[model samples]
Target: MPAEERGKGPIVTSTYRVQLTPEFGFGELSELTGYLRRLGVGGLYLSPTLQAVAGSQHGYDVTDHSRVRAEFGGVDGLRKLAGQGFRIVADIVPNHMTVPVPESGNAQLWSVLRLGPESPYAAWFDLTFPVALPVLGENPEFTVDGDVLRYWDHEFPLRPGTSALPLDELLEAQHYRLVPWTEPPGYRRFFDVSSLIGIRVEDNEVFEATHRVTLDLIDEGVIDGLRVDHPDGLADPRGYLRRLRAFTDVPVWVEKIVIGHERLPADWPCEGTTGYEALNAITRLFVDPAGADKLIQTFTQRTGVSADYGAVRYEAKKHVLSLFFKGEVDRLESALGEPGLHDAVVEMLAAMPVYRAYVNPGEPPSAEAVRIVETAAAEAGRRTDPGAVARVAHQVLYGPAEAVTRFQQTCGPVMAKGVEDTALYRWFPLACLNEVGGEPDHFAVTPEEFHAFCAVMTPTTMTTLSTHDTKRSEDVRARLAVLSELPDVWADAVESWSGQVRFDPALDYLAWQSLMAAWPIDVDRFTNYLLKAAREAKTSISWIKPDPVYEAGLRDFCRKAVEVCGFSVASFTAVVDRYARVNSLGQKVVQLLMPGIPDIYQGNETTDFSLVDPDNRRPVDYAFRRALLDNPDDDTWDGQKLQTVTACLRVRTRFSADEPYFPIEAGRNAIAFARGDKAVAVATRLPAALERRGGFGGDTVMLPPGRWRCLLTGAEHTGRVPLAHLLSRFPVAVLEGS
Candidate 1:
């Protein structure tokens, strides 16, 4: 298939991402069709709807692939929603399948356990039997039933002729071994999540079976597009995409993370990434590089953390590998058949700049892949054995097939766990800059760089500001960006707050930042966020390593901070309130009006002060939003945001994403651009700095000659417009040409 035809699917004008859970499923979504239509969304970008473990909140842990989840109103409810005329962009998990608590919840996995290697479904998953399941506790006891082996409410299938034997003898006869709960499993898993077992989707048979229901939905026109979750986790991402494209050409977007100046491979048969690149790019425009030094210095001074992010990240990766990825390292080390290469392999994996190297078996590695291997090896060599680095690097590119494939697969999860989960929490110079697939050390992007990024965006590629995975919501980051301008004031406030109610010095700075960033948050929300932060940082406590006394102190610290320092934090927020609002509105307008099919993550149409999962996935009070829309109030921030989003979406239809983009020469405080001949987007960047410099002050953006009306405020203009006038009411101005 031609690469141009690879990702082509239904034309999605705009999307509203709905987190589908038992609380909100297809039936619930069906009820919101009228509201969604009014919200200017053309498609429902849904979370995974495949049948997963019963009562699963996020459906990424899919137990079966052949059926739409009955809990999510099943296939009938989905078809009924499709009848509403909105495109359905389904989020699909192709990398792994869930191993539910009952163990029998996934029939194929159960059958495999019962029948061993002779099971017809043996090829479906990547397993190395006797499969080592980590379900045993210390001093574990077992009981036997008619055809099952039981251990404290957990059951396993008994092999034929093994049910009549002694418990110990029966265990020996079984196809799988049970180990202590803390031990890593012997089978391939999605990251360190042993329950979410990795599937061999690279196999054609596996692909057919796994994607059958989704494909059937596509054929039936019930599904219009696909958002492939965690493509980097797949063994042959490029090959898997090619096979998927062969089957159907719906706008297939991979949840691929691209780092600094790295473009998604043009040859890959899919649409671009699900838009961390765009998210970072949008964030960069608002972040002032000038403030990086002050912020870094302030952060270091306050928390005693090193200023170097790369070093901090490298250490974090090494720590994460030792803690969570020892099983993967051991597997690769065993595959290499080379002695004493374990440390070198770990170092290289830790040193990897991107998620993974695209070194598929038989086919030669891409230049990008080779570069990544060489770069990581070079860096790894600095700390470990250079000879080992050379040997491992060679093996990665030209060694055993199993070694090469496993090495590639392992890098992504290692990076994700080490960086996104660990390093991001550890390094806190400017929390706004610390996003997925982004370097916080690299503080900001110039307007020219942002424009260059915007110029090449794929029309149908997804663009978004916030997602379920973001460290903070779009508005939260927007609010935090104001710190770049007022770093001195922020530093003083933290010092004063610390004096009043202090925690661990290493984490106190971050806690204060979070408190102010997500202001109006109560005790429970604030304490829960801090606890997660403490665990993710793995400083004094971690998810695996529980410290009861330390955690209690952490909780008490949060309470004290909120109760004693809440008033002070609120006062500081009030000071930067206007500027933060400007940034919040500005970035929203820019992201929505820019190229690509923008997604409005639930409740982000107004303002969502969320932090990470479960928090970000909190129930959106749509009734409140609906009421606000019913009675529009420009006087309020939420109302202003609603007005901005609706305006951008309204005029977004007039501008073709692939059309010629003309960059308008506005002053440095503002970014201005025209999308084709139809719409012009102008947003205030660095509002605090702009204010410091006596405002727009004769700064003008040359508009196209002819009548143009501001879509946001309904103001009329005929040519060059002053920045102050164009953005009088709001910080962003979207003008539609007459």
Candidate 2:
């Protein structure tokens, strides 16, 4: 397996995370190749390109596995991109498939519905026997038409002839049992999503069926690598990876969430994680740890929320289980064979430090994971059902693979829904620290930790600052990091503006902070993001049943936030702009020069201040970016952002995987490191601290003790110098051996 032949090579991947809908499909993406190439991108890491549920913006809800998305120009478009010599890394959803209402497009699911247990495809999905797929309200009396099964307002298309039977008989004849959407049915699904059913990809037949097109694309040279989405949801991720590796020898990266201090399982066959850990490490290094108390104070005063992240996480998990995943909890309890053990299980899951432990049957569970479970159970104050605990321990440690698999799958979604989606919006400590797989409680990443992480994991890691699912863009986060510098100014702005408008205290605090970070925001983007943010917080309103009165209040607040507070907005923007420039260039330099295959999210070359989802996925203005790239004299902050990225990436191409990484002894206000003897990245971490300390008056950063040319300014420097001299030209200095 030569590096290129095995799809394992040094890559500077650019992530195209938006879906290929009719408006922006393959044709649209194909136009960016030359621009990407010129930007120094080595490959395109694409979103799920397979067929998905109709009109899905992000292709995670894949409905078909055997072909490329029809709207995205299918295989030909992929070949076209690859034909241009750009390596393609495709995202594959092996854990689940969409279960649309009509059941018309999915042949296998429809067959199972029509033929019950006798259908050959019945074994493909993770359904308990005498199968019941919940499609209608609980115990509803239904009427039937020619081919429609009607339950109240909903009419579902059953198999043509089966509709002729009474609704009850028709339901009984189907392999899946249709229950209310609210019911946590026995079947495994992707998280608590009722419409996305989990596939038994651990089954040899299922794996083959689901991965047919993916394997073909690899064989045909259209795709050079694989990114396995939500491997935590799979029954046997390790086994599946092994099978996938055997099936195709291409490099693979799992979308595995490694929490604080946890590493990816050593035994799994893959390149590395999709890089949330690295994202956490790099981003938090830029955040000021001293601001944690003030932010928590503001959060507490307004929202009346506690500062304890763990308690909030535990309660949020409980809330999700009770309100949303009641049936799933019930099922897990049943599997444990003890009714009282429900809370205990939920407690253990909520306390799980990492996404999951890689424990195989007949093998011991990781001691650390065992300790986490035991501690959570004790702290939950529920007397352990010894027998039930033993049963669960057996499943987690030994056989009954399905039980353990479901348990593992359950932990990730609970953590995601409880923490990232819910608690992150609630906690206003720092929006940047509340990223995916990041711990808000842990305010900063120490230099020692960052160095150690890069030493071992950087070789195969996929480091990124922004991604499609990020709560905020990298630059947006960069701007927000500046808020830590002037906590008093930030607190004053929040207090003064918040006095004029009435909104949910906590939500308002969060909104104002976010608005400051992305100041001069438009009405539409602000309103939409606020609405989504409020719903995700779920304190006052929710996604399923939004509170109209609360939503109206939010809209008013958003309007006032932009229209009424011009002075405060101007003041904050000025401060943010100054610090944002430093943060932006520093991050760009470090990310590109860091010890990993760095990925630049589209449109992030400039100072992107976009928020999560639809906001982050908005169409890129390539023309504007290209114009900036072409105009060397354009000294705007966006140009600086682009220049820093370009210079480091070009310098990066010269370094090999075996390049030596030495951490530099830059002062506390800055971080500098050398990549071998050639590349030195000196990034300013705390601009506020430096300004207070009188601009590195006596501080010095020892160079490689030889002549080095500044990559950005082309200035020459030798040996030690006032750190001010090194960073006077740019907030960050990227230098190479002269």
Whose TM-score is greatest here? 1
> What's the lDDT for all of these models?
0.87, 0.77
- Estimate the lDDT of model 2: 0.77
TM-score against native, each model = 0.98, 0.94
What lDDT is obtained when candidate 1 is compared to the true structure?
Answer: 0.87
lDDT of 1 by residue, 1-738 (tens): 222354444377778899999988898889888887787777889999899988988999998888899998999999999999899999999999988888988998999999999998998888888898999878898888789888886889999988999777888998999998788887889988988999999888989999999999998989988999998888889899999988888878889999988878787877667889899999989988888899999888887889989889999999989888878899999999889998899989989999877888898888888988999899999999999999999999988999999998999898888888888998988898888887888888888988888888777678899998889998889988999888888888888998898879888888998999999898899889989988999988999899999989999998998889889899998887789888888898888878777888989989888987878999999898887778655568898888888888877766555656778888789998888778888999999999899999999999987778987778898788889888888888988899
Residue 395 lDDT, candidate 2, scale 0-100: 57
The backbone clash count of each candidate, in order, is: 0, 8
In candidate 2, residue 652 scores what lDDT?
A: 74
Per-residue alpha-carbon lDDT of model 2 for 601-691, expressed as tens digits?
Answer: 8888888988988988888888999898897557789988888888877787777644788888887888888888878989888788778
Worst 10 residues of 2 by lDDT: 10-19
Question: Could you say which candidate leads in lDDT?
Answer: 1
Candidate 1 regions exceeding 4 Å error are 1-10
